[model samples]
Target: MPIALLLAVPLTRAPYILSFSFLLLIYLTLAESYDVLSGYSGYMNLGHVCFFAIGGYTLAVIVTKFSSFPLALAFLLSPLSATIFALFISYPLFRLRGAYFAIASLALGILLYYIFVNPSFDWLAGGMRGLMINTSENRSIISYYLAVSIAIIAILTHYSIPKTKLGLALLAIKDNEDVAKTFGIAPYRAKTQALVISASIAGFAGGVYVYGIGYVNPLTVLNTEILLTPVVMTLIGGTGIYSGPLTGAVLLMIIQEVLWVKITHFHLFIYGLILVLVGLFMPGGLLRQTQIQKIITRLKG
Candidate 1:
């Protein structure tokens, strides 16, 4: 990958490469989080951005109010706050199923948006005005490094979880709840673990995002588009494997960069059309098709 980047640098230039790399890191982290709940646990969390927003807001408030703290401490607080928020809601949320769960999550996100917009909480989040980070050219480079590190950490964490008992239990529950219970796997506990971990990763990604963008508004955090990017990336790339999100993010980023410039207003229309076509023909996603064929060949052998 480094060698490929080195060769492409002449054609792409350093700044564009750096910028896309930053976004790629963010996408990779967030996509892994999405897959833990949606792919592994079969829980559709449409409002996953709520956790991300919480992390961004938490970091913004902490860094803005207590600027004296070490940067590392501030970053930790962001995801910690998000994790706490996830834990607080997970019990009640775990009760809902299918479309109900998805709708409830979406509602929670909208509620957070309203709370952020409220005059009473205006001071907390700068209300609609948004929170701004103290910036420097050096800080930007530091943020890019932070994003890359977080992405790598998220990927490692994601893969490691599935090797643990809790991870296996979650997969068991995902396949069949009654069978998992017969084997003594607590379905609710496994689901909550996946949800909390996914939310925390997203929270960390949100922190990196705010640091990079240097601004945060409720609109930025609560936007449906922001929520869908990771989902679409996961589906397009394939969700059942660890590398799927990374592949999807890279592919989507390239397509967006290439076509977005040519069709600014109708870019989403084109994207949607492509998605429809992919769904009709690919079904199991681009990567899954290859995997399915390989499995069939092996079975025949």
Candidate 2:
């Protein structure tokens, strides 16, 4: 509610204020979803954006072809498609641990990119040129609401999952797979569920993003920058708690927006320098600063 109010109030009634809020929500969802699997479960999935792209493309194909379906329905289906894809891939992929798992996901993402770009699949996805979506004039407002709702849902889901029996199982697996197996935790299954849940939310975000942007292509979907953005956000925000990703996303987005306008070409260099300094001085993330840690410690004490 506080976040919503912060988003609602503007220094001036500029449309860009709303747009920034919408983008912030989008990145928040993406970052939080990434945290679920990678941060909490200790499974590093480098292909998180693949699930996101799948969701966006799934909705795009559906809405573009069958204009009769409600946008909400299409949005729902996008995550379902992502879940199905995750289910199929998780079994084989979970066998690989750590770097191997990461590589496999990255490979899968690249493979999917190729598939989407293929001429044969062009009928479904509109090929390498991409599909342009026609949206209502109030698309920005609609997108803002949708993005905020999705961000809330993602945060709730992340918090809820870690408290359930299944979440306990996942935490066990994260701590020690061999020990988790002794307790019948089934690391593979837990990992798969985490992947599916994370991917589904990411895909849902993608669906909303497509509507927000009105167009998508291989360049947008397959870009390394898009894939890394959530990872960076998660790391910067601190990953263990619900607010970490949200903090990271907001901070990073603000920096990106403000710095890019002032120094376009040096933005990436500046971002890199920030990351380096953060790593050296505040390895736990900006949200995990000494002051915040002290407060948390005092509260626990």
Candidate 3:
């Protein structure tokens, strides 16, 4: 029913609604993807958005370099590039754990942001100028549908993971890595798998995002705020649960819209305050609240 409503959203012909829905779905995709790795595996990777930036830039570069290249192929390459990068860095990144791992991951994002924004790389990445695509009039509609499909896929992936062998391995590692290793679970293998999958989904979603906007820039795709959206959303919604990111994305987006319109001057301050409040009062996330849990249980039943 929710998906049906999303499908019907384009029919409303309201640009603002479409735009809002698109951004919501994109963040939803990112949040779910981030949860798959950090939430499940207990690895708090701050650089996950690097995959997203890579994806957007991958398509941007392909289109800009080979103007005649098939857009579909370019779109597909987005996730591939991200997955490859994940595979390349998985081993080294997995070697570190906890705060060390997180800081390293964040450094990766900052490095990429500077690389893309630096004028020295202008010949390839367009530097601070950014890259633009020639999109059709119906580009927004197509992007919306792509985002919806990808978001659904991310949701399903997050849901199915906990039921799979990989999911159990991750849970075990999350609880106690040394004990998981004793049980024949390869920590690196499982974590790498989660990271790759997470990167791929975020990459594809990033592609859809840049395509929809018809342009890409370092700040737009690789900014600190953009990188943190998924983490914040997942934390707000409830990590380690499939429904958490969805709930977070919806609730945060609504709050953001309201704040943007009603309190433009201090919206960021208000937003940060709200996040702090959530952290202090609902540390386990909004969904983990006993009342909310009861509601969910009744609905499930």
Q: Which candidate's TM-score is highest?
A: 3
Worst 10 residues of 3 by lDDT: 262-271
lDDT of 2 at 88: 88
Clashing residue pairs in candidate 1, if any? Answer: none
lDDT of 1 by residue, 195-257 (tens): 888888899888888888888998888876776777788888777577777778888888888
Off by more than 4 A, model 3? none
- Give the CA lDDT, 0 to 100, for residue 49 in model 2: 87
Alpha carbon lDDT of each predicted model: 0.80, 0.84, 0.93
Which scores greater on lDDT, model 1 or model 2? Answer: 2
Per-residue lDDT tens digits for candidate 2, residues 1-301, read: 8765854744346777877787788889999998888877777787888888999998888888988989889999989999999998888889988789888887888888888899998888888999888888887777777887889889998888878877888788778889889987878878888888899999999999888889888878777777778888888888767888888898999889989888858777898898788678776687789898798789989
Reference-based TM-score, model 3? 0.97
Residue 247 of model 1 has an lDDT of: 77
Predictions ranked by TM-score, top down?
3, 2, 1
